[model samples]
Target: MLIKHLIGAAVALALGANTVMAAGFASLGEGLTPLGGEKSGNQAGTIPAWNGGITQPPAGYQGSGKPHVDPFAADKPLFTITKANLDQYRAHLTPGQIALFDTYPATYQMPVYVTRRSGSAPQWVYDNTRKNALSAKLADGGNGFTEAYGGIPFPMPKTGVEAVWNHIARYRGEYVVRRASEVAVQRNGSFSPITSQQEAMFKFYDPKGAYADLNNVLFYYLSFIKSPARLAGSAVLVHETLDQVQEPRQAWAYNAGQRRVRRAPSLAYDTPIPAADGLRTADDTDMFNGSPDRYEWKLVGKREIYIPYNNYRVSSPDVTYKQLLQAGHLNPAYTRHELHRVWVVEGTLKSSARHVYSRRTLYLDEDSWQAAVVDQYDGRGELWRVSLAYLKNYYELPTTWSALDVFHDLQARRYHVQNLVNEEGGTIDFSQAPPEDSEFKPAALRRRGLR
Candidate 1:
């Protein structure tokens, strides 16, 4: 199997093709797992092989809207990593994670759990991923992809940008409606939640849709603020474009005070996300999003690291936000970490590009294409922020996605949290009926704001 992969890589290089093809296994479920991870486990046998993942909901799973039951509820932590024994586990930790211990020695700790490779998607997604591995190619210089829809565009990624594209185009669901809250925790651990209702249609992943139907649009999203009188009534609409270099992302903002929807040109790149208080950027919303043209990406290969995984406890309704949110980071008691293989991709900002982050490193899970951890650096070659995705498989949708995305600022002694639906009734509804195209337009933003 190893020789087959080497021969395939050699053939690709000899052909001198511009299309970045997978180094091994032309199709899925061969030398690769269904979603393109290594089919076999490591030599140590700590991380188990992908055994068809969580295809069905476990016992006591009510539905999509209710809290999901943790399948590993009976499992306990194998060991814990703390400042006291940081050196012992230094080989399996990221620099940003090690910095966390240094920043808050007393409260920071990681409860390592047994690795359960519970990442799976719908059967159709697996089918599409196999087809994509043979045909999909990068377009617009890594800013967009072609001949790919409904699944990961680069499952057996060959380049750094290809790995990032897999994360960008990975299937979440056809459509989803989620009501969640955002909070920018202050240095003193005080926070005022900015709750909002969000709806999105992944046009690229629509079962009935085709590449031509996309019309260069990736997804349509509309977010309406629903809390704290002063911040309520405001809304934002976005048309995420695939080829961002040729056609940048289109965004609009509806201000309650002005009662008008205006084009938001400064909503991309290093633009600060609203309500995040400069703790996160617009592109930093989903670990990383938008264009990859600003930076030169390099595939740094794979490494085994301890990352947050199967984190159902942190987002459980039984655990309130007060208990979860702490000073330097989220409370470690509710979090779960496991060792898994991750593709390390580094993006260095181009000389011509002007952005806040000079360098960015993404840790992409091998099983799912999700970017589980990200380390962002500033111009002075200093680590500025670290982002973590608490990934859990939504058994109903059968997709692995983040329950909560946390960004910690090492310098400011603050952090920003997104997608906090622990207290919300409906949680995340992946079965949402596909919304009309008009509902995501700028005109709709004004109409909804007026109502």
Candidate 2:
């Protein structure tokens, strides 16, 4: 383990002694729903509780690996939230979301849609998550895990760290391959496509793998940039691990310019991302990543809020890039927000932890344990960046995840939206099977880079 003491070892420092054994499997049926969502929806009818999620495609659906046409394309926005009516919806808006409107009063807005609780996983996954609730436990100050694999580690989460762990360990299928683009849109709405072809093997989420089989690895990722001559031929390979205390994340970069394969320790924590131009940090890639060792995570309880949901529209081939990318944010018309209950967790930087973000709060969707909304704060405790992820169901796998991820910088008036493939032929090819282990190896990256 990276830390000398685990949460189970130092119960007093991690969580109160009362919470050490808080979430027993008994709570799953009574208070918590089977999928870890609240059994009952909110008191108001605005948000509906999750029943059986969207396991099949809508009417007129094409086969997998094709473009995902929005099922709700005909639906209209229930209402629009803007700077002019900030006071009316302050209760549902995060500090970061409100800041965006304040910064770009005329441009930034949110189009609210009706709530839809339609995201489900395979039967084996739900069974594994239930099993994990009874067996999984934290290690080395929440940096490692024991007795968990192929499921949400902490379905009945009792603390903040556990909630975040659920997000990191959430199911996203065993493997995937896609052609996508990331655009760091400038203030004037002009941007170049930092396009790439990417593949991942979610070994930890592999249904057949057991906790003992993980060996501390989470997933194997490879990204090869394919656009704009300046950044082409550069590739990154990451073997994300569960426990940094045992073995930290293994990352390597094959730089076409240098023609070398070198170990990359700088891909974690506060390091500026390679192609983001200093707008985002390495750990900021998936809303929150790397390790939770540098901060004190606190479970801030649950709340009902409007978040990005069922955003298939943004990924539709019919929607052009120009219509989606705005000066400060994605065109609000294409964005869809709906009310959902989420687990709120806050991470405050430890005094000894050296990182750029002092405090960050993540809003995790209760149904999927996905970090739907993230508010990252600077050293001065001021909100600096806001991230929103629109979740949609991959009907073939019956898994739900981000269709588009937008990271906005409040101070710079710049942002990046990754996983955009409207112009690409296929949105995301889910029909492919798990990749071979050799494909993610460092030598493979070199060969692929040279090719």
Number of the top TM-score candidate: 1
CA lDDT, candidate 1, residue 266: 49
Q: What residue runs in model 2 are displaced by over 4 Å at the alpha carbon? A: 1-31
RMSD of each predicted structure:
6.6, 5.1
Q: Compared with the true structure, what per-residue lDDT tens digits does model 2 show for residues 132-226?
A: 77677789978877887787778877788888888887887788888888878999999877778888888887766777887788889888777
Q: Write the per-residue lDDT of candidate 1 for residues 125-211, one digit (tens) a residue.
A: 988877776668788777888887788877777788888888988888988888888888988788988778888889999999888
Task: List the global CA lDDT of all models.
Answer: 0.84, 0.79
